[model samples]
Target chain A: MIFTIVVVGGVIGAIFFIKPVPKYYTRYGVELGTNVQITYATSKGNAKQVVDEMFKKFSDYEEIFDPWLVGSELYNLNHSDGKWTKVSPVLLTVIKDSIDFSKLTDGKFDPTVGRLIPLWGFNTDNTRNWHLPSPKEIKDALKHVGYQNVEIRGDEVRLLNGVWLDLNGMMEGYIAQMLVEMAKKNDPNSTGFVDIGGTIGIIGPKNGNEPWIVGIQDPRGNPNQAIAYVKLYSGYVGTSGDYERYIIVDGKRYYHIFDPKTGYSNDYLESVTTVSTRSIYSDGFGVFSMVAGEKAMKEMAQKIGVAYYAINENGQVIKSANWNEYEYKK
Target chain B: MNTKNKFFSKWDLLLIVFLVAGLGIWIGIKQFSPPAAKAVILLDGKVYKVIPLDKNAYYKIYRGDTYLMTVETKPGAIRATYSTNWIFPQTETTQVSVATGWISKEGETIISVPNKIVIYTEGSKERTLYDAMTYQN
Candidate 1:
């Protein structure tokens, strides 16, 4: 009888150790005018339902953030005609964050270039609809392009001198952080990531312990290719490249990322990838680096305490010394 | 000797063997025989179809009677041939999806944002080097 009891106890302990690993599930969708891919592992077996709710949240936020969409909160704010209009919490928060980032980058990355987006005919997705605007047109749009023109009092915001705002610089990172938060809220033990366009946020470590390896695309290479890779266990990684949207004219490539001062795309860098503890920094730093060039990029990275990797227009790769912390060498 | 004082009896030994064998089988199936490579296509956040990457074929995709694009699949890779956007019908597209070329790796994806379509491969024999990729938006 004693021997039997010992055997039974041992068998029970073995069974506890043999619990199955959580299965990984990846779901894809389109939201915020970009592709959304989420991969998660949940031991509770509610992964599908949790992901469905996450997509629903993405769709809801897309309309609120889309600057070009008619009837959107941002659209109403842009067309407010210099009057202080009460804004939604989401819009107010983004605008506040935009201003803060603008100050941080010293206007290198500005969201008030909304007028230039259409002036260069880049407001539409169709490449055929895009064209090089006349010098006068760009000059006129630059007249209304300055982050300082935005005024916020309590919950009300007014665009001075008809300066429109475009939050694409930091929108993806903001949404990615929200999705990761939702994932952890649903299941605290969950491990996964949310990728909106190219901005990625970690819900948790891969398989609850391992880092999620992320690849940075080669700016001049094919879309499916990667020039380098990074290991991320938490936080976010964002890349800004000139190849994403561009037009070639007179043997010169002009992209969509506009310089607030020049009213033309910045061409100093081909790509800029940043890793930050905050998603907004991860997303916005690349935009800052693109317009600011290498010297300013180095200063900004040190000041903001973020890691970065960049390839210049001449195909020279540069990285902050701290980037060594996240490099994934295979 | 009394049987009660023994560390293990014949039945106890047999039970241990049965338990160990069951655990071994479970691990083998879970680790060794992973599913074959296949492409998962989504339309407007829904699972439109799943096509195994074992043969050469072209799959035409549509949304509510509107023809969108055609996906070409070969033995180990897949790509979108062409896509049309109704919103800018007259304007030529950048053909970003078609420009992506063949995606044979497990984690690579092809996306047509205007059409609300996404395609990604899974279950390759070799694990993907990266879980996700970053690019300029």
Candidate 2:
């Protein structure tokens, strides 16, 4: 009786004295043409204020990055008529980064497909506006879609030929990383995440210790269901799939992520997810993989040292060797 | 001195019995009396409305006079049935949210990004397995 009493009393004491979990504050909304969620718990106060500030950054950056938005920096640059136009530091940084990625992937993830986007009617938010372009139209747009045509001297950028720049591929991850940097600067011990669209950047580890488990959405499954899970203690994860912003005509799906050479959405893969230490790679690799197919994806992963998990057109799961490190099997 | 008397007097025995009974009752209440789940709807990142998923009902979401979406709720589950873009109501752009069907689990969400609407559940006993999710942008 004494032993039982002691044991029960000790158990009750332990349960009562266990460390309390931190309360996480979450904010969700639409920004940068997609859903944005910011969740965090900080030892320092003013978490809500900081999160609102982060959301404001999205609209500010969208004005510069969104090519379709009239009077946006990119819009003005696109219509500069071959003259050197001075660009903002942020715009110049992303443009230079995009050019490097284009060279790295051998034009697999070119940002100069701005002409092709509007031709396919994907430049607008309303799906009613989306339509299949004729073969002649595609051919015409492909002529003006080349990353090498962009000439940058100093802080000024010049578009050669009729090429236009679309920075959508890496813009979300860049913004997410910027938000993460802000969180870290405000509080080093902050624990939270910044999700811009589907690309995610960890502000810090979960509760300052555990890895945050992130689910990867199934390409052909329900919106809330996840086909796989990844454990992210830090860094970023992003997915590019053919499911969103797609229009089906005669059972043929014409989605956004266009191929520069062919000026059509590639049918190589259904979805490609990448986990990387760099924000740009997390966002860009999926676009690169979607266009380049499986063999090129393997080669690109090797060259860039990023982990990828992909589902092919036939619904086969393929992943890189390093992907196992971040994959949560359960 | 008797061993039983020395170890636990009548008062000690009664104290032990009281504590055990209290602990059992606490555990029973925790295990059996689960709280009702609630669905939180947000418009533009602000709380628009909150509905308890304890009855069958429909909620029409509108921004001022412009109808945006309709939310359906049953006992312990909620879903978006008909959602349209505020700008282009005639043309059904994408039915991803409506096609998502019912989301009953806590942390499950149905999002209409163009409409700037989000609906998610909370206070369910079965928590979501993952902390976050990644999908096509």
Candidate 3:
């Protein structure tokens, strides 16, 4: 009887003590004019299905948010010509959030600079065709470039000054947030992340113990190179840099991140990366820091309670007071 | 001598051996299995192909019959080569070079936005520096 009990105990221990390792699934696709990658860990083997549904949701959101797309909600609103356009609630929410960010950054992160984008030939297909807009054109475009010109009531949005709303900066973060929420809803126990372009939203911790390691792109190096790595368990990370979409004219590099005040690309900083509990804040603050430069970035980051890392034109690395806390030591 | 018997009998020893052997085999299988390695290629956000990294091979990636580039692979490594396609009116090539050559260890990638192609390695043991690389718009 003693022998039989010992054998049964051993069998039960063998069966019950071993835990199945969680399987990781990664899916990649292009949406919203950039690469979208979703990586998640789940023991139930439903990551692919979950990610597929998320991508479909992303497409629906893109149609509402993408201004450059001809029939998109924002596109229709932009071409509405002083009329109050009925927009999707998602668009309304994003526009409202963008205006708040503009106010927070003192118009440094204006989405109303949509007119300037085309003037700089950013809307065109070929970067070789991109040129500096004439001062007269710049002045004319700047006339319509103020976030205060936007008015929203219920689901109707109007550009009061005939200004266009460009939600590019804020939309990525919002989408990231939405994807994170979807992932959590699908399986709260699953761990993973959603990366829309460079805007990243964390689902949860890796294997419930290890934090996700995110690398900051080196401003002077290739796309795959990293200057530093940040360890994060949750929240969002967004980066704006001069290297990605820039044209060199007469030895001067002109990037796409524009300053509302100057009506041109800001050259004060090479790159700015922001980390926040909210993805929209990360996205907005990154663009704000790029336009506002290092000193203002520090001040704004402090006021808004976000961590930031900035690389100046002189290649000097600047970090917020709490920035080092996120750095991965090993 | 005829009346004597051991408290710890042969049956106990047999049970202990069986348990120990079973646990050792289970642990060995869990820890020693080699992870499968593969190169995942994405074209415009969708998985274009997944190629095993264990063999030598060559693949020419194209978008709608327009030849983009060729990727050469060796055991456990991959590289991009001979991209003859021009990016529209620009004089620059597609600018996807693995000329620094051969990304074998996982997490390394070769990407060309103009061609909308991305190639990266994936494996169980592989670690990546970033969850994703963000570029300036």
Candidate 4:
């Protein structure tokens, strides 16, 4: 009877003794349909003040640092007379990064393809409208999609031809990373994670003492089954998939991630997720790996320092060497 | 104390448990978990072989005995991957000095070994193998 009482007492003790993780939220709805979300997990720390400061610094959509709103500036720059404009500093850096990616990918992922996106009517909203791009139409848009057309002179930016720059792929991941870093800067003990769209960034730790576990959406969410999941912490996780944007034809489907060579979406792989220290590298490499397909991805990852995992159409998981070391759940 | 007060007063007991658990985890993490390895596999340096696949589950065996890592094949051996080191010395674009050429001396240029991944050209008599690529244990 005494032992039973002690056991019961121990059970109660375990529950009461644990320190509850505290969660704080900071969110702002910016202009131009842009939104930012930041979450901070603390043991005994408060991050409200720090997070507010970060939001204020990053909230100026019209300023020289915001990357998301700069797409509008690039849009206007290409439409104006052939002259340079004092563009956002962050946008200038983003364009430089995109041009670098275009060179690295051999024109595979060109950011200057802004003219091509609206032509497909994807800029507004696209879930149903899918059509074949006529040869004449594609040729006209292709003229304005080269990386060499955009010139970056220090803080100023210029468009050589009528070309637009779109940082949609790089912006969300960068913004998520920026917010996480800003929170950590004020409170060294800040332990939290941010998930935007499919991109994920973790600042300190997940369980305050453990690596944060992230769930990857299964490409096929019919009855809501996870195709596969990965564990990510202290890094950025970016997933580019065929499911994001696609065109479904008679008994078949097509997607947005295009291969520049044939001007069509790839047929080999379904999704590719990359993890890296830099959010930019994670964003660029995630899309590049999908475009490179299975065989090429392995070779590139071996050469590059970034780690990644890929999911093929068959739902099989292909992981880089140390994937098992990180605690991954389905 | 009432039954409700008895439960509520358990904070004193809980505080001790919390500190002990937190300290245990803190010491455990600092004591046990090694830093994340930069180069996933280090070869031609310190030699450590995994005789058992149970504990050393995170290492890939390239060569030698210490780190004996193998792929999970229900029926057989692994099908060589591009990034992995292979038995058929890869001389592809990524692997520069890997030789597809067979060196011969005594009896013949090539010979076939059953139960092993074989290599041979058209009308060739023998197969050659120096190594095999393996996954982390």
Best by lDDT: 2
Candidate 2's DockQ is 0.54
In candidate 1 the C-alpha lDDT for residue A302 amounts to 90
Say what the RMSD of model 2 is: 2.8
Q: Tell me which residue pairs clash in candidate 1.
A: none
Alpha carbon lDDT of residue A4, candidate 3? 58
Candidate 1 chain A has its poorest 10 consecutive residues by lDDT at A120-129
* CA lDDT scores, all candidates in order: 0.86, 0.87, 0.80, 0.53
lDDT of 3 by residue, B27-84 (tens): 9987887657788888877788898887788998888898877999876777887565
Worst 10 residues of 4 chain B by lDDT: B128-137
Candidate 4's residue-wise lDDT over A1-330, tens digit each?
A: 343466578879988997776574533223222222345665444566665565565435334332234445655666655587877666666677778878877777777766666555445322233454666776787777777887777777777677766666576667667767776776667776665444667777755676655545456542112344455558877777776345555545556565655456676667677777778766777667666788777776666667777788787888887556553654
Listed in order, the DockQ scores are 0.46, 0.54, 0.35, 0.01
lDDT per residue, candidate 2, A1-330, as tens digits?
A: 565577678889999997656678888888777888899888787888888888888778988998998999999999888899999998998899999999988898999999988886788776667788899999988889999999989999999998999998998888889899999999998989999888999998887788898999999888888999999999999999998777776677678898888999888999999999999998899998888899999998999989999999999999999988999977
Better-scoring candidate (lDDT), 2 or 3: 2
lDDT of 4 by residue, B46-84 (tens): 222212212222324444443222322111111112223
Query: Which ranges of candidate 3 are over 4 A from the true structure?
Result: A1-15, A43-45, A124-126, B1-36, B54-58, B82-102, B134-137
- Per-model i-RMS: 4.5, 3.5, 4.6, 23.3
lDDT of 1 by residue, A1-330 (tens): 466787778879888987566688888888888888899888765898888888888757867888888988898889989999998887788889989999888898999999999876778776667778899999999999999999999999999999999999988998898889888888888999999998999988877788999999988777778899999999999999888577777667788899899998888999999999988888799998899999999998899899999999889999999989999999
Selected candidate, larger TM-score, 2 vs 4:
2
- Models sorted by lDDT, best on top: 2, 1, 3, 4
What's model 4's TM-score? 0.61
